[model samples]
Target: MKRILFTSTLAAALAAALFMTAHTVTAAPEGAPAPYRHVVLFKFKADAPKEKVAEVVKAFAGLKEKLPAVLSFEHGLNVSPEGINDGFTHVFTATFKDKASLENHYLKEPAHEEFVKLIKPVIEKVLVVDYVANFVDHGAH
Candidate 1:
């Protein structure tokens, strides 16, 4: 019957549309999600004084104001908070919409560069982990 054929065709079309949408949503931008992770860890040099570390922390916190891509910034001097143990001097997490935004934060933002320059000498090592947002809860933000 013509009705049966039309119904089948419609079902096929709907399936195709759904597949396309799912594919598009899953296909994140380049470097959006790395296989490993996106964890930026910074270790300051031993020569850095306590006051200098505090100053650098303030400067790093100010990055959010200078860059729109950086939606939120969570930073603090690494300390064993009660029972939790974090073995590091400092830690800051920067979240962006995509990898491009993160790259722009480094390239386009002048203040970011200044912050880098200010802490370059005292910085021991920096670790960066880039990854995609597999499952994000919008309500949490």
Candidate 2:
């Protein structure tokens, strides 16, 4: 009788542990902040003049001013010593409240279309990535 009781208790404990693990893996932690991040990297043509590149940069920075959905915007030229940039010189990051805000900025905004038109001639390559930012506070523990 004792052996049967011990087996049952062990099985119950294992099941509970598995259930808790699955639940934690599938659910976001309470109070986690989700921000949509838009990342853009540009590689200008080798023969593009410095003045034209500067103009493109200025036009891109001006996008935040024209778009209400842009929560924050920043950009910089790559200075990494790793030399793995693949000829990409400039990177621009913009944060929006959510995916819908980003869509509005990228799709419906005329300013964005104009910027694209401006850069098309000078751009050699472009890469863009967008995702929901996951912020975790390690100090909360």
Which lDDT values do the candidates have, in the order given?
0.70, 0.86
Q: Write the per-residue lDDT of candidate 1 for residues 29-57, one digit (tens) a residue.
A: 45555322235667878788889888888
- Tell me the number of clashing residue pairs for each predicted model: 8, 0
Give the poorly placed runs of model 1, Cα more than 4 Å off.
1-38, 79-87, 136-141
TM-score leader: 2
> Model 2: runs farther than 4 Å from truth?
1-33
Model 1: colliding residue pairs: 32-131, 32-132, 33-131, 33-132, 34-131, 38-129, 38-130, 39-129
